[model samples]
Target: MTVRLRPTLAALPAYVPGKSVPGSIKLASNENSYGPLPHVLERIAAAAENVNRYPDTNSSELMDALAAKFGIGSDRLVVGCGSVSLCQQLVFATADEGDEVVFGWRSFEAYPIISAIAGATAVKVPLDGQTHDLRAMAAAVTDRTRLVFVCNPNNPTGTAVSGAALLRFLDEVPSDVLVVLDEAYHEFVTDPSVVDGTTLLERYPNVIVLRTFSKAYGLAGLRIGYGIAADPAITMAVRQTQVPFAVTQIAQVAALASLEPAAERQLAERVAEVTAERGRVTAELRNAGYQVPDSEANFVWLTNGPAEAGGIDATAFAAGCAERGLIVRAFADSGVRVTISNPAENDKFVSAAHELRA
Candidate 1:
């Protein structure tokens, strides 16, 4: 007889990661094309000597480092394998069967999957102008809504909601329902008007802001991220659901090293470079006649999908880039998300786009 698996998983979609083609300039994963900072690499190398031993289950050193960097109490935080892992933990800690988890439809792909795995219903609100429709999301909440994820500077689309709009949405959401502001791309954001989730923590005890070392810190391979919550109870709940030793020794040391003053300054300089490249790429794409959204993150969005007006087939575009030795993330018929890298890499992708148009 076949072993019985949870029937709900039948319709659940598997997370599709960005493809990697050797020798190609990859902009598919929204990764910092610049790898780990020098000091972080040193820490990782030093920690490699102790791989035989288990990682610290509590990730105490990393936690303390993050606490000091953010100027918050350690009790307000919980480290996870990545912000994506924390996404799952948030669902596990708050939602159960018959409950609902709310988020934007195309925000983070993990939102729906995590909800399904936890046996919670997914409530997805459509974007307003390629950004989170905060009002619609707040309206989607019901008495059974246990968790809400707001992926600021949203994935794929790379559009962010304004601070005022977000605050309004937060005001409308029920205080008991958890609102997780997934800011995995926080370091890449340059917009002054965008909502910095951490700033709202004191005002909304229900809100938790998620940040990651993966992107700007150049530690994507290390998979270290954290959540900041005003309520100690929420932090406790998330920690309780975490897998023991999920953050490895190497990852912890790398993250701690990244918090060093010199390392942080270097990271900031890199972020500035990415931001400048983002503007250049966005302008170039728009001049080339693609409906590119205003991105506050490390990537730019091309809203060319079968359903979008004057939309180009995103898969075709991605294939074209692949042929030109550049890789970008394509969402079937939805659109393409391209990471903003060094000037030369960005120019290469732009040239590919022009070639595709030709």
Candidate 2:
């Protein structure tokens, strides 16, 4: 007989990552196409020499570097396999069976999956104008609500909430509820009004800010990310739920190298390039008659136009791009998300957008 699995497993939606075709220009996953700097590569190679040995379970050196970089106490920070792992750990930290975890729909795709795995109910509030509707989300929170995720510069949509709106939402949430600001794309944000989640820590003790080395730092393959909790207790809970030695030595050292002054400056330049390209891409798509959002992250979101107006929905548009040797993420019946890359790759995406425009 087959072993019985949790009944909730049946209804859970599998996470579909961006497609990667060998010969195609990939703008599917919101990944930085620019590779690591030479110095960081050197560090990764050096770290590889000691793979036979176990990684430090605590990732002490890396943790120290991040703590110092952010001017926070070491006790307030915790590292994980990626910010995604921290996302799961946060669910484990505050959520229990039947408790509700509220977040905006069309935000990070992982929120619902993780909440379900933890036996917590996922409460998805629909976005207003392709952006987080903070008022609606805050209103959805109840006493049973244990955790809330605000993916600022949201994934797949590339839209972020203003600081003022976020503040209003925060004021509405109960002080006992945990608010997680997943800023995996923190490095790519160009908007001045998007609240830096870190700055909210002092006033909101329940707040936790997550960041990653995978984006602009070009460390996606290595898998390392971290979170800073406003309260040491929350940090402690996240740490307690972490898988042992999940952060590898190579990832740890690579992240440390990426934080070096020279590396930081170089990475900042790369982010500037992506943001510049993002603006160009959005404008180009709009000019081509696509409904594109003002993106703050290293990607642009295009709403699927009305089918009655000879428009194509997300799936059909993605299929069209695939035929043209370009791969982009398509949220069925919703929109398409195209990652900003180097000039050549981005130009190919823009051309595809024009050809596919309704």
Candidate 3:
């Protein structure tokens, strides 16, 4: 007889990351094309020289920097290799067999994957139009639901929830249920109505706010991110679940140095530049007859629902872009998510879109 196994573990679908091609403009992962400041490079180099020593298991210094930056107490801060890892830790800490994890469909592709890995049932609520339907999401709650993920601006679509709407949603949901406010792209948003997630951590004990250094900070390769919350219990659970010395010594040094004054100014400037570029790209797409919601993130999502543009299917569109030395992320059959990496790549992508027409 064949040996029995944990069916969920054996049968779970694998996570597929965006492709990387040599010498191609890769706008696939929503990473910052603007590299980090010069001082951060020096810090990374210095940390590299100390590779023999293990990283601090608690990552105390980086945690102190993060706490000071966000004004959150150090006790409530949980550092991880990436916010993605924290996402997994959060699920493991709270979810048990038969418990349910909820998230909007087409938000972060990782939500369901993490839920499944944790042995929890993944409940995906469909998007209303192109946005996350908070009312529908709030209504989908059941007694077994222990966690809900809210990614804004929602991944692949780039639509963010309003401050007022989220406040109401929080009030409506059960206070005991943990809500993860994944704001990986929070720095890119220019909308006036969006809530400052860091501030919300002070007001909402149930909310765990996640942020990364990969986007505006241009540290995707470094793999440093953090989770902020008011609840010591949740933060402590995540800290306990994290592997010892999970974050590299280089990552810790680079992240701390990135929080310095000049580095932050550089990030602020880059944020303004990228948001403007995102606006420009969104308008260009809309002018070409594609419907788009206001993108509050660095990437733009193109829909191909019941339609095709000049014989260009969504997959074909992405493939065509790849052929032209551009690597835009394609969400097969759903749409294409194009990252605004830099001016040169953005121009190449725009050229590819226009060229595909002929």
Candidate 4:
């Protein structure tokens, strides 16, 4: 036995993050156009003086603050470098060799790859009409399935399942099979039917809500995020599995300050702006000969399909847009996924769409 590793880890592809160009407007990664608060920057600057010291190994202060804010106990929550890291940890905790992880195809790109890395089989259910079909996803479950990830306002597609449908699906899934509701974009949703992960967690014991400060909080550079779970076992495993002092001191301070009532109020206004822009920009794209979907997240989904659900491919179209200086994500043969940034940049995207379509 020379060097045999886990087959799943050996076979999985590394995650490809959106590339950053020097002068190009990056709409590829779903980052907030608005920078972090001036106060957060100040806190970071102050913390930089203590670079020689290790971070709080337990992140006691940050966890306590999050628990109080979310109305969950400390035992129910765990923080990570980012929500993506929390995702990898969740798979490690719940899934074992030969276990299954179910999710919608073309949803979050990381779900399948991370599932494989955790020694679990990834069961990718195809999306129905660019949305997560709750019934179909729920039905895909087998006894071997250990975890199910529901990306609310599912990434790339930006379509979400209705609250009623989600409630029903939760009831149908096995209580033992952990259902991780990835609500990374929950801050930008404007629709009434969409489920709020914080509120939903009160009703579902097995549910683990994953959130990030990278998006609406405008702390992408800090890479701070957390998981909200009801059980102590999961949280304990996560706290132990994580490397010592992972979340930096500055991140803890910034995140805690951002959770203040005043900051939340400000965040609400920013969310309103994004929601409005998403509607406006999506309509403009549709008017410009693009087949856009009814996106409820802080992004829009466009298809160069329908006329040829087999005709002009979306990846090719995305590549064309990249050539024009606007970076958009193309999901293979499926449509393109554009993450909505700020109002000014959205206008630029709309202008680019008109130029390309015209």
Poorly placed runs, candidate 4 (over 4 Å):
1-6, 306-312
Model 3: what TM-score? 0.96
* lDDT scores of the candidates, listed in order: 0.90, 0.90, 0.86, 0.83
**How well is each residue in 139-223 modelled by candidate 4, as lDDT tens digits?**
9999999889999989988888889999999999988888999999888777799878767766787888899999899998898
Instruction: Mark the regions of model 2 whose C-alpha exceeds 4 Å error after superposition.
Output: 307-311
Candidate 3 — which pairs collide? none
TM-score of predicted structure 2 = 0.98
Worst lDDT window (10 residues) for model 3? Answer: 304-313
The TM-score values for the models, in the order shown, are 0.97, 0.98, 0.96, 0.94
By TM-score, rank the candidates, best first. Answer: 2, 1, 3, 4
* Residue 294 displacement (Å), model 3: 1.5
What lDDT tens digits, residue by residue, belong to model 3 across residues 1-358? 9888877877786777889999988878898888877899998998999999999988899999988887778999998988999999999998998999989988888888889988899999999866899988999889999999999889988999999999988888898899999999999989999997777766789999999987878888989899989998889999989999999989999999999988888889889999999988878776666666789999998876643541236798888989999888887757788898777778778878877755
- Candidate 1 — what's its lDDT? 0.90
Report the Cα lDDT for residue 21, model 1: 84
Candidate 2 local lDDT, 152-252, one digit each (tens): 98887889999999999999999999999999998888788998999999999999999998888888999999999789999899999998989999999
